[model samples]
Every structure is written in C-alpha cells, then in structure tokens.
Target: MSSSIEDRLRDAMAARAQAVQDEGPPPPLPLPRRSFLVLHARWTAPIAVAAAIVTLVAGVAVAVRDGVPQRPVAVAPAAALTPPFYVAAIVTDHTVVSKTVTATTSTRAPLGVYDSRTGRRTAELPVLVDSQVAGLGDGRTFFLAGRERKDAPLRFHRITLTPDGKIGGMFALPRRDDLRTETLDALAASPDGLKLAYSVNTRKPGRKGEVRVLDVVAEKVRRWHTDRPGFVDEVTWAGNARTLVFSWQRVEQEIGRETRLLDTSAASRDLLSAKPVTGRTTFFAARPGGSSFLTQEGGGKGIPPLVEFSTTTGQPLRRRIMREWFSPQAFDSSGRVLLGIVRGGGLARLDGERLTLIEMPELPQGERVYLETVW
Candidate 1:
C-alpha cells in the first residue's frame, strides 16, 4: 500500500474514534433559536441527525453540528422551583448493536440520572430494558417491573439507588397478575411513596378488572372494582396520596375498533366516585409533588400543539398552538418544575412560558425515548 494511502486511513480512524467522546464538561450544550426551528418539522425529521433545540422559556438554545450537539448558550439562570433531578431513558436503535462500539464508561448507561438546571449527568444507573422499569421519582425507589420469562408471572421489585447509581438494595413485592410484561404505566405510586395503585385482571370471565392500592404504612391492600367487564386505562395518584384516579372502558364486541393500541378515548374516575369525571382524558399526567395534572392537545396519537391545565386546579388552563410539538413528561411538587419531550423526539424543559431542548448527541436510528421525573 502507498504511504499516502496509509496516512489517510489512519486519520479517518482517529476522527471516528474521537466522535464518541463526550464534549467539554460542566454546563450542557443549549439548543439555539435556529436549530429549534427545525424540530417544528419533527414528523419529517431525519433520523441520526443532531436536533437544533430551542428553550425560549429559559432563554437557551443548542445547535447540532455533524450529528453532535455544539455551541450551547445560557440565556439565564433557571427558576428557583424548577426540578433539579430527573431520570432519563435513551432509546438507541435496534440495528446499532453491531455498528457502534460499546463503552464501559458511566455516561453510556441506558438509564441516567441528570440535573435539570445544569444539564449535568450526575449518575449512571443499571441498563435495564426501558419496558422493565417503572419510575417512582428521583429520591424514591423505582420498580424493576419484569418477569423471569414470557411464560412467567409478572414481577415488581422495589429497588433503591445510591448517589453513585448503584442499586443499594431491592425487595420483591408479592407477585401480581395485573402487571403487564412491559407496560410501566400499568403501575403508579403516590407522591408520599406511602401508597401504590395498580389494576389487575379478574378470575371470573364476566367481571371487570380491579384497581388495588397498597398502603405502605399500614401494610394493607385496598381494592376497587368496576361494575362491568372492562379494561383500565392508567392508574394515577392525584397528589399527596389522598386520592387515586383511574379510567375504564368496557370491552367492545369489535376487537378491531377497541384494540388497546388504537383506543384513545378516556373516562377518568377517582376513588371518591363510581362515575368518571365528565370529559376526563387519558393524556392528563399527575404532577409529582401534588395532585395537579398536565395535558397535551387531543388524545391517542397526533401532534400535541399546546399544553393545557391550570397549575393550581389541574384543570384546563389555556390552549395555544405550538410552533413545535411539545409533550409534557414530568413535574415536581412545587408544580413549578416541568419537563416535556418534543413531539418529534428528544427532551425539553418548560421554563415558565418558553422551552429549552436538551441536545442528545448519540441517538441510534429508530430509537424510542422516555423521561422520568427526578425531584
């Protein structure tokens, strides 16, 4: 081989090796205004490209260059009440297993603990299947929801993580039949972490399912059942552990119309009443520190144009069209700290009225990502 050709090959390998390293440390790269504009067309966004992120609420912007997030500019210090802690799930593409090099370092964990204000990745936790994990919030223990195998009954284990992201310890709760093999939304916990609410299948062929709550203090389980045979939507704790809310839909004769994946209808019911709250929606998510909730536009699958609901009442607050798709992910107790992912993809923090996108450098093709609030 010619010496010139050999030199060229060596340089190419060095550049490829350098690309995988984390950029300059400390404050994260902010999304810029120009880059933010591109995400407005997220539905048609090209995979494997750096996303130009915009966070107007916090006055920050991040620019993605060569599939790398670069040129971060801080608009101002984040709000005082904003959530400082959160857990993030990075969904890499399935096909990349053989294409990229796997690192044994801390930043590459599928599950990561991040500081919202500083954009610092504080700890790297176990790399469990995204479907096998149920977020219990930052300071509280998380549920490693899983089963031994496809034939085995579902298992829910409460595991605590230390500051360094090591599993401090884990305990298995009594196995339940209702927990799905991979659906984390099937389980929920109250803000106080004193109670858990879940929906399980019924043995009788003609009966509706049961929504059960386990009180940690008393170590007693309480059960609530629907009048007819139906499926429960999501079981959410309405702040403070004082009220538990859920939605149920009766089984329809037509399986094609009522399929779980396609169903978007919602009928919210609180523990206080048999009737669902009039005009309740499945998109509403309970705020972390309180019973308040936040919702995106419409139901099922579509672009969420705006976020709605009063911070105080958790009721419909206002609706305004968004230039880009922003989906609410998590909120802290103060009801002040809010996290939302762009409708197209990636993470963004809601600053008062403006939004700042968190630039993710390494996204595998066709990756699926979700955020867990860490307050």
Candidate 2:
C-alpha cells in the first residue's frame, strides 16, 4: 500500500475512537437472573439493550458540564414516608325552626379526632360556633377559627394533639383587632410552621378580596389585595414555603375562575400581579412537604376525579385515579394514601388505585354533616 493511503486510514480510525469517547458509557444495566447461557445466545444482545433503555427512561437527571460539581438529587425514600394514622375531622350541623311566623337558627361545629385506620372517633371537643379549621404540616398542630353568629367577629385559636390523637391543648392566637371583622374563606399553614396564609373576603358590595401572610413567631403580616371585587379560595402552600397556590374569581367580571400562584417573597401587594398557574380550577390540594399537588376535574359518570400535578409548572404529573375516588382532601406524608370524602357522608382512602371505604360508626342523630377532614 502507498504511504499516503496508509496514513489516511490510520487518521480515520483515530477520529472514530475519539467520537466513541465523547459519547459516555451506556447507562447501568439491570442485574441478570439465574438463567445460564444455555437458555439462549441470540437473545442476550436484545435483552441487554432493553434493560439499558429502561434505565435511561426511569432516571431523570440534569446534564453535567465539565468540571462543574452538581449536588445529588435527594429523593425521599418510600419507606420514610409514613402513612397518617390519626385524622382530625370537623363535624357541623345547622338547624332552623319556625313557630307561627317566628323563626330561629342555630349553628355548631365540633372538632373530633378519629383513628384513621379504623374510622373510630377517639375524642371530641366541645362545639365551636361557626368554625373553620386548618392543620399545620406536623399533623398534630392545627388552627381553628370561630364566630358567635352571622356578621359577628371571629376568634382564632391554636390546637395541639396528644400522641394518642386526643386534644392536647387549645390556646388563643394573639388577637389583631383588624382581623375580627374579616371572614377567613381559606387557610393554610407553611410546612415549616413558620407562617400562616389565609384569604378573607366579606362579599360586601364594592369590596376587594384580600390575602394575608402572617409570620407566626414575629407576629408581622404582609397583605395582598385584588384589583377588582374578587375572592380567593382553596389556598394551599407549596413544599417551598414561599409559594402559595389558590383559586381566584372576580365578582365584577365574568372571567370565570383561575388558579394562581403568588410568591410571598415579592414586595408587590397587588394580588393580580401573581401569575396564573392553571386554567379555571375549582379545587386543588397540596401534599405536605411534597413537590406536587392534586387537582380535580368535573365529572358526571365516566370521568376520572383526581390528577396529580407538578407544583412548579401546574402540569399533570401522573394519572392513576380510579373512577370511584372523588374530592381528595388530604395526602399522607409519603403521598401514598389519599383521603377523600365519598358518597353517603363517609370517608374513603385511595391507596394507589384501590379505594377503600372507611368503616365509620353512625354519628349522633339530629342532622349531622361532615365539613372538612385533615391529618
């Protein structure tokens, strides 16, 4: 062979070797089973490629640049995420009586603690008048709001639970005279228990809706007001305590409902300045210390009820809900158990795709209603 031709062939081989080095090694392969080589020879290559593909698809990672040190993604192990064992339920009843043109009304809400596994009421607190309740991420600390009657000032209290799921203590929050007249439509506590965020709208004509974030320890508050006469509901916090997700609806305009994300870290006080996360959502619930949240779609007969969504993009993360499950209210720490209300005034737990109706005892007669539940 000519010297020039030999040199060209050698250079071509060297270029091909460098190209292979640039494309890093293949993804780690799955461990092989006990099948010996006697089973099949030709199938080995195809099976190995299939295993590599599975590894690549299942593993999501960020691209690593040369000499850049990236922190390893910390994924909470399934074993560490424990299912909630105790549940705090708010039970309420309203009655009205009319006697020969004279009418009277009464309202009462009783906070009850139940064994989540057995659906048995372990303890009950005395009735709280016209009350609303929200739980801190710790699963034991809760906040309760109550009022004497319609158009009356509201009072706030902090509730603690014993290890056995009984009421441990109840203490009143430092009163702010400005908050007495405002009605709390929705409330959520930060995962770290450092702050409380709530939406208050009186619904009086020409009044705008407002959202407030109060620093629990500091007792300082920051307010955000809507541009128009609107109200916010279903207020929930993302795992990163700074972001809040809620549904906004303007009463003056016919713009329907919009799910919005508000960053409390920002200085702006205008609520509308926050961006919309999803389109016209009626309800959504966030998992404690989780990066995802659950949102539901309306249905009549054949539609799936719940969809897990990424809190960052408001995009559906997974779709594995059964047709029977509906109105998801809370999620266990590991997000494996979804607690929701089902037909006939009972609670249901959705573990994976299987739905189990909790065996609950009958409540005391006299028109009972289940308002809310949390763990």
Candidate 3:
C-alpha cells in the first residue's frame, strides 16, 4: 500500500513539472530553512504583494519622523529686516578753552562760553530773558535778540567778554519798527565775522505772512514773496557769504514746509520747494562750501528718515533711514558729520558712524545733552 501511495505522489509531481515545462521554463525552487523559506509556498504571489505594501509604509514613516519637506522656505521683506543705528562720538570738538562762569542769571541759566579746542566752558553771562543767541567765532562776542518788554519792540544786543571773563561791552541795536510785527527765526554770522544774516517773519491781517532777510554788513533788506505764508526755519551762509541757503514753510493746521536757496548777489530768488508728498521737514545744517543741505524728512510711508539735498539743484545727495527724532548738528573740518539723536529722555551724538553718549553738566541732577555748534 505504501509503495502504491509513493508512486502516485511521484507521478503527480512529474505531471506538474511537465505541464510547467510545456508552457516555458519551470519556476525557480526556493530553498526551505533559508531566508526565502516562505517564498517556496504555493501562495508566493500574495506574499510578495504584502511585502511591497510594508516597504512603502515604512518609507513614509521615516520621512515623517525626520521632518523632511518637499518645498522650500520663503524670504522676508528687506525693509522689515533692517536694524536700527545709534550715535557715537561727535568729532566737532576741536578745542576746549576754560571752565569758568562769568555771569549767572536769577533763573540759574548760565550763559556758557565754550572754547572748541579745549572743550571747556570759559565764561558765562547773565541776562534777564531767555534770548535767542548766536556766537561769534572769536569766542568773545555774542549776539542776542528777544522781546524788550511786554508789548514793546524786539531788541538786539551785542555782549562781549574780556579775556579774564569780564563784561567788555553791552550795546543795544538800532531801534527798528519793521521787526515789531514779526518774529526772529534765525541768525548766522559770516565766516569772516564782518557780516551777519537775520531772518524775520511778519504777519498780515488777511494775507500770508512775509519773511525778510537783512544783511548787516551790506545794510540791505530783501523780502521773500511766496504763495504761502511761513517762517524761515534756518539760514546758512553758502560759499562766500554772498549766497544764502534757507528753509521755510507755510504755517497751517497741517504742516507742509518748503526749503529754498537764495542768492543775494543774483538779485533773483531761486526757490526749492519741498512738495507736500511728505510731511513737515526740519532743515538741519548745510554743508560748508556746497549747495547741499541736510534735512530730516518726516511723514508718509516708504520715505527715508533722513536725506541730504542740494537746495540749488534740488538733487538728493544721500538718503538714509536712521531714527525718528534726530538732526545733523555740525560737521568737522574733515567732513565728518555730528548728529544729534534723541532717544527717550536723553540725547546722544552720532559722530560719523559711531555712537557716543552725552551728558549735560549744568543743571542739578540734570544729565540731558542737546545740540550745539562747536566751531
């Protein structure tokens, strides 16, 4: 019976092999007790399908664990990524003379006389009112203008100091009625100290205000006629004291200002109007011997925070976005600029490209530093 059974099984296996050979080559035999033991089963097609599904699942899991993505990261806007700048030391101080007080007012406001070389306060003068003052390069003489009395005329005075911090001279200016209805805005002295520029504003009942310029050396006065009424913000001597660069704006509830460059020798006024595209602009220092003036441009979006332009050509020289409240106070002989940067309660100096902290030494417990011209 066993032989009969074995013969039957062998004959069945032989018949299967013959059928497979008739079709093509016989299928490869997978060896048992090896890595491919399960592949030898008759259900090899189903086992291969299961293995392919498992491999795909494992690949997806690895990608998720490693946090790999199919796309790239986006970039941010340039303007939003820009950093802020702080001021360092101002190089305008070339000398410091002495540390002395010649006079002190009842209000305790000492008139400080500074020597640019030594960076010292040489003398101080006491005056009645808080006056608008201008210093002469000689470091001894000063020009002050303010209201004389409650309803009286505006008075101009010349105060001079001796070498020993003594009051050398104090004289009143010539009485003038033209300045009665107007306010004094700016005063600039010529480099030679022989000439001075005075800007005054006058108010009319029903018309725009008028601004006039007086040349003390030439003893001449000229009125600037504009479509808008405004005050002269600044007056600066250009190349040779013959040309003057000034800035003014129409006074309204809304601040729209314009800066102009005037040539007293030409007898024709050259106007550079800052369009109302931006907000109110404050004129700072004008570059010596150049037609360009530095201005702080405020208001509107996408506009630079600071800009320097040629008042004659209306060409922009340099534009940068630095701080909100700051101005170009002075420039050294080497062309380095001294900037006054106001942050919170204190002011600092931005010298060239460095930031230097400043402390006011006059007031009691008052360490606030402001802007002043050195030389």
Candidate 4:
C-alpha cells in the first residue's frame, strides 16, 4: 500500500482501539449488505462523497381519505394509474451500526409512516434498537433484526402495530441452529410473509457459499448452495412468492457476477433464468413488490445509476437518473411506482418517465434524517 493509505489505515486502527477502550466491546455490526427485502428501508447511510443533490420537481394537489391536500408523489403519464406506497423513515443517531453510540438521542428507533396519498406523516412507530426496518404487508406491522452484543447471534424480530397504529409489541423470531448467526448479510421476507430468505456473512474465504429460505409457517428451512467457489450477495422475492431473485458472484473462476432468477416450486427447484449483463459485474438489488430489479452499470468504477430491469429477461425497463446514482428504496404495493432517496437530495418518485418531487421532511438544524420505504 502507498504511504498515504498506510498512514490512513494506521490512524483508523488507532482510533478504533481508542473507541474500544472508551466503550465496551460493541455488537456485531448489523450490516445487511444492501438490504432490498420487501419494504426494507435502511437507517444506515452509504459511504460516498457528500455531494449535495438539489431536487426540483413540479407538483399537483391530491386529496387523500382525510380530504387533505398533499403534493403528488409522482406525476404519471397521462391517465397512468400509479401505485401508492407508505414511506417509512427510520430516524436515528447512530451513523455506523458496527461502532458504539453515545446514547444521547432517543433510545428507540423512531419510524415515521407517511401516507403517499396525502403526503403526510400519518404515524410514528418507535421500534427496538433497530438500524433498519422492513415493511410488512399489513400496512402497520414491520420486521426488526438486531445483534445486541458483540457475540449476539443475528436474529429477526417482528414489530406489530396496535389497533391505534402505535408500536404495540415486538417479538424475536424463533432461532435456527443450522444457520450461521454471526452476521446477517442479507434478509428478504416473502410478499405473503410466509417465507423468509437470508444469508450469513460469507465474504470471507473458505466460508461455504450458501443462503437459506425459511418457511415461516412450516418452521422448516431450505438451503440453496450457490455454485461452488462463489457466495451469495443479495436475495429478493420476485412479484410472485414462488420466484426468488439473488446475486451470485464467482470467486474462483472468471471473477464476475450474475443475477439468478430462481423458481422454487419444483422438487429439485429450477433456475428459471439468469439475467444477462453486458459490461461489468454488477449485483442486482430487486425492488420490493415486483419483478423489476436495480443494477449499477459502469463496471463498478464510477458511481452508476441504479438501472431497473425485468426479471424474466435481463432487459432494461425503466430508471430515472438522479443528480447522480439514485438508490432504489421501495416499490408501490402494485409494483408500479418506485421511491428512491439520494445522499443529499430529498425523496424522489419514479413515475412513467420522470421523477416527481415527494415529501421532504425538514430536519433539525445540523440534523440528517434517514428514510426507509415500503408500499
């Protein structure tokens, strides 16, 4: 390594040691290597140059059930019926999950549920010490996962909403002995909430290349071994419950990646189709609630806009370039509209061919709000 990089590394290590001395050994970082699960919203931020993205969008007034006027989330092509979604913003103080926090802010993660129809913060549900959240279809409840301590096995928890729309209860998901529990590399819940898919951290050499799909109702788990010499990166359920989409990268071979669209209906299971890519190795982040997924182009070099492609065939469908690469967060219940947030820009909605302005909550001075979304 160069002298400058070496110095930077040395300084970072020293700082880390100092932090450990100050705080007790921290919990295993809950790094869901780009969680794209159904209604999955990240409370964490990405490492990138803090480029300010100025979002300017025209608007229209639409009325919701309350008859309240709200700025439109998206302006569809003429007569296009856009799907609606509920925006969930998980506001927190922790910048990095792996590190310890000073515990100055609210102890619980505050979840703000916004009505897309009215563009209003309908309810705020306070959850466990969660850094991310996945929207459950019930429109109120959600899933929370955590690693409370350094050696704490990664586990899933459910956050059920009360009749009044408050965070009524939180419960741990039953633990499985067959699965590795140290890290949660990725997590995806089936649309129907019957199946849960997740992979432990396998980025390390010699770790088995695999992923597990849990049958929530049956309480049984099925394992999918990625082609040997390769590991799974991300997983998502296609529009239908029986189909699954995942990222598989070869570690020992050509050193490239491909998106696997697998159908899990047959006894032996069938690899329906592997989405083909042209230029470079890119992992696909499937948008929740649909067959469409997002992938970065430009060969993993400069930042690339998340491109939307069809799962049946790896064909580009739709995507709106932001001031830069816009992260795809959620899709509407109908899998029609896509909601994305930028590093510095506020929320954006992808309609027919344009990005319409959505609700941007004003943050306290010097405060930043992190958002997660679901339909």
Candidate 5:
C-alpha cells in the first residue's frame, strides 16, 4: 500500500511540475544523496520513503497556503492631525504713505516657530520680509511667496525646518513671470508639498481674476478664471487635494460674498464653475475630502461662532470653540484642528470643542501686531 501511494505521489508531482510553466520558476529544494541511502537501504529505505512523502506533503501544503488570497488586515484610524509645532508668520513692519497720513510704522510680529500646546515660540527663521507663508501638513515644510515691489513678479522659496523647528535648508521654486504682473491675494500649499493653489486678484476694470494650481516638481500650471469681475481669495485645499475651498466676492459689493468649492479636476476654465458651500462666511476652512465646511459667522457682538456645516446638505453639524479676535487661518491635515489669529495678540488653536490660546514672541516697543501665520 505504501509503495503504491509513493508511486502515485511521484506521478502527480511530475504532472504538476509540467503544468507550472506559466509561473516563473519553482523554489529551489535540496535533493537527497543517493550513496548514503544505498549504504543503509534496509533501515533507511522505508525511512527515506516516509520522509519523501512528508516532504512532498509539506511542499503541497505550503503551495496551497501561498496560492490562497488573504483578507486584508484592518488598519487603525490615524491619530488627530493636530501638529505640535507651527511656522509662525514672517514679521515685517512696512510704512504706508497716503494723502491722509505719512508715518513710519513699526510693529514686531512673531516670526519663528511656536509650540501649539504651551503657546510659546520654539525657533525663529531669518528675516524673510514682505513675504507670505504657506505650509505642508507635515509641520516643518513651508513655502514663502515674496516680491520686491507690488508689481514685481512673485518668487516662491521652499523652506524645510528640522523637527525642532531649526532651519534645515531653503531653495527657490521655478519662477513664473506671469505671476509677477498679477497680485497674489492668497496662496496655499498642498499637504504633500507637491502643488500650490493661488488666487490672482487683478483689480483691473474689465479683465477677470484668476485661480492657478502649480505642480511644483513638474513646473506645470493649470488655470481657472472668473467669468465676471470678482475677487477669489482665502483659497484652502480639501484633504482630497483636488478640491479647493475659496471665498468669492464680487468687485461691486461685498454683501453677496460666498464660500465656494472648486473642483480642479473639472474641464471648465471659468471660476464660476465652482459650487457654493456657504454664504456670509467671515473666514472658512474645509475638512478633508470636501465633505464639510467650518465658517466664522456673525462677529458684530463678541467672538463669532465657528460653525461646521455639511457640504452635501448645507446643514450645520455643530459649532466649535472660538477665542476673542480669532480669525480662521487654516485647517490641519485631519481638518478637525484649526489655526487662527487672535487680533494683535498671539495664535489660537481650536481642536474639537476645546480652544487654546498660544502666546506669540514678545514684540518690541513701537512695533504693531501684524501677523500672517501658517502651520
């Protein structure tokens, strides 16, 4: 009976080996030495036969196990996207000469890294004056949009800081001459640090304003223009990366100001192609995947309520915490945490229902608090 089973198994293995030409190659296996087997044929013969059957069975079991598909392992949800550190605003005091007033105004604004929990500054960057700042969700990478004059072309600098907020390195992005002629009202960096969405608000009479997305590494640009005369600013990207949440207001009146959603994947070039999310939003941020929006509505009295609303149904989900003079800046990667300005004071963080006030670096005397900060 054993001899018959061994013969059958050998024949089956030969047939199976022939059928395996479709797969690349079989795994290399050791062959038994014939001389040792012959010397101990009586005792070793039966043992070798049993061992051969066991080896074949084990190989078959292994092949069956590897061939079967496995159910995917369930991954745990990610922790809250609140970053511990932030790249505060670039501090610069500029003087405005108008017909009504001419005075040298100076205010020392916070221009470095700061702790989100304790509200203390962690590190400082060199003076990058007259520049706007944007950040990737990672908390260390940032981009500075700078120009020499109002009409000068804008140059983008990519900055990376160490985990401790110390300067790592800096480099310039590809320069685009076309951006120089237009005014950059808003600039937002994608979470992946590969793309940028900016609004060009040209105050010209008839010409339309523009929204542009630049592929940083590829040096390619995609543009969408406003159909009518309106300004589109405060552009923020949904976690999806392709959806943008921006504030749009007509050039004639600010009454009908609306927060709208733009799908960059759309084929349309007109800015009006964007869908309306909410209206009367003082400042706004969108959650990842464009599923909801958080807006600051009503500020005539005390602190305006930071309300979260469903984008699909346009219904209020819930209201969040707010500090005095809290100006909604941007949302963290998870879209749950918010970073905002606290008037002439320090930074404000809203995580869930809890609001935390972070202290900025002390300003020198005679310096006003003009903060344009980022994470």
Candidate 6:
C-alpha cells in the first residue's frame, strides 16, 4: 500500500513540474512533503460512520441557506494598479555606499525607491556609516545616529537628493546622550510628507517590551507597552496622515500567546485596541492606502496559512498555504505583494498568481535591500 501511494505522489509531482515548465516557472509546489502524505492518508480512509456524520452536517448547512449553492467570492484585482517596484544598487563614488552586503547585515544596506507615474527608478541614494534610511514617496532621506565617543559625539544627518540624482539638502537629528539607542526600531514618513513616525523599543526586566511613537514634526513622543520580548516587528504608516497601525505580542499564562493591534491617531492622542483571530501574526507589508496588510498567521508545524487581512474590518482577506517559512518583503503600489521564501542560504520572491519564481538580483556580494514602502 505504501509503495502504491509513493508511486502516485511521484507521478503527480512529475505532471506538475511539466505543466510549470511549459508555462514559465511554476508556483511553489502546492503541498509540502509531509502535508501531501497526511492528505493522502485521509483520502485512503474507508467510507465509515464518522464520514457520514460530517457529510450530513455539511449538507444541512448548505440546504438551510436557501437552496442557492454557496461559493467563495473571488476578490477583484486591485483598482488603479501601480507599476511594479524594482530593486537596484546605486552606483556611487563613495566607497561605503558601493559595496553590497547580505540581507542579514544591518550596516551599509541598499536603498529602495519607487516613482509615481511611470514608476521608474529615479535615483539611488548613497547610505553613509551609521546612517538610517526612510522614504516619503519620491523623496528619500538618510538619517545618521550619533556616536558615544567623546570626540565623535552623538549626531544625525539627513541627505536629500533630486530625482535626477542631484544632492538637494542635508540636516541633523537632535543629539542627546540620555536618549536610548535600543529604543529605536523603525522610521516612517506619512503619505503627505509633513510628519514622521519612529518606532522605539524599550525593555525592562520582568515586564513586557515597550514600543513608543515619537512625532518628529511636533518633537513629542509617547510610550506604549507590548508583551512581546524583543522589538515590535514593523511600524506601518496608514494612508491617513494622522493614524499609525502597529502590531505587538502578549503572553498569557493561561492562554499561551496572543497578538493585538494598536490603531493610534495623532489628532485624538488615543490608542484603540483590536484583536485578530489569527495566532502570532507577523506583519509584512500594508496596502498603499493603508486599508489592509499582508500577514503570516502561523509558524512552526500544523499552523494556519499565510493571509491578507483588512485592517478596518479585522476580517480574513485572502489565504494560501506556504509550504515553508516566508516573510513578506514589500507590496507594490498595486496590491501585489513580494514575499521572501527561504531556500538554501538566500531569499527570492515566490510570485503569486502573476509572476513566477524571480531570483533577487546580485548586488555587491554583501549589499542588502532595506525595503521601506512599496509606493
């Protein structure tokens, strides 16, 4: 019996591979190895009492819903689709900016940009030592964190470059020793380009980690707590300039683990709470208008699939089972998401319904792409 099953599985895989080759690169194989075997076992089960009970229940539910056969609704392709965003290495005379590094390297990461109409690559900005980069639409700015040494002192710099690659202006961040370094996690520019939001991490023994938001425009900051031990995963800027949507984890002695959302607005100075039914949500990328986000629901083995969710409604938007671990890298202005599926020692996009497996291009060997926003 086992031999027969193995033969069938092999045949099925061969057919799929042939289909994909004929059509271009295929999507990741539909099922992982272990999942395919478990599904096969269930299919081979004898028709018995338990199966009858399940069938009866399903039939009743369908029948009671008015005789109209129920079917899952297909989502429409995103309206006003934006051009695909591309990753490129900036050619620069600066030595530090030219060298490339792996995705894991925090220092000297590559800068990513997206144009408005044509969605063309405008200009690649050079990243300096200890410099942090963030985008507000077409304009890209780099921030330099201050150093601890007495002679060097803590300082910050902002590099503004024109679309044609001309240097525009430079500024500095306020310097202070008391300011905690670990507290800083991510920096984001509001869609309008008037304000900036910084995700700061704070850790205290016996208490949950805290991520605070600092309003760069107003020069004010507020602190919030999360039960997650490390830093908050990512800080996403909503379409509306006033609101910021963020995720944090909470550990419960009785319940095991829980994840929650904090919708904060600068106008009201309030943080509203919304709970997602999915477990241990890892936020990847948000839609252009910030109405929704692409998220991964489960981890390890036997978990819920990766999915997209509407931030406003807290509803399950779409789902597909990824046979292996993957992280959402970015979302283009259109609703298409770029995911980094782990294979070997590198990462590449397992394009969904449209594009096929696209190997990320090689930059200077060590260089990495630090994605901020797709738009």
Predicted model with the maximum lDDT: 5
For residues 84-167, write the lDDT of model 5, one tens digit per residue: 677765445667789998777555444577766665676766553345578875577788776767666767888887766677
On the 0 to 100 scale, the lDDT of residue 64 in model 4 is: 23
TM-score of each: 0.53, 0.65, 0.52, 0.53, 0.65, 0.49
Q: Relative to the unseen true structure, what is the Cα RMSD of model 6?
A: 18.4
| Clash count in backbone of candidate 2 | 0
Tens-digit lDDT string for candidate 1 (213-295): 66656766666655656666566666556555555656654231111110011244332234334333434456665534555
Q: Each candidate's lDDT (Cα)?
A: 0.51, 0.65, 0.50, 0.54, 0.68, 0.47
Name the better of 2 and 4 by lDDT.
2
lDDT of 1 at 74: 40
Worst 10 residues of 1 by lDDT: 256-265
Which residue pairs in candidate 2 have backbone atoms (N, alpha carbon, C) closer than 3 angstroms, thus clashing? Answer: none
- Decreasing lDDT order of the candidates: 5, 2, 4, 1, 3, 6
Residue lDDT tens for model 6, 1-375: 476775665566555445434433322222336975676567644333334334344433433345344442334654324333333333222324335642332433455444433434555545432223444333344343334442343344455665553446667655332444344455555555445555444445433445445455665556565444544445666565544556544333423434444555533332224344354566555556666667677555654466776666666678877676666645543334453434332333444643234333333443333333322
The reply for model 4, stretches above 4 Å from the true place, is 1-132, 137-139, 147-154, 162-165, 169-181, 203-209, 227-231, 249-257, 266-291, 294-308, 315-325, 343-345, 357-375
* Model 5 lDDT, residue 336, Cα: 67
TM-score of 1: 0.53
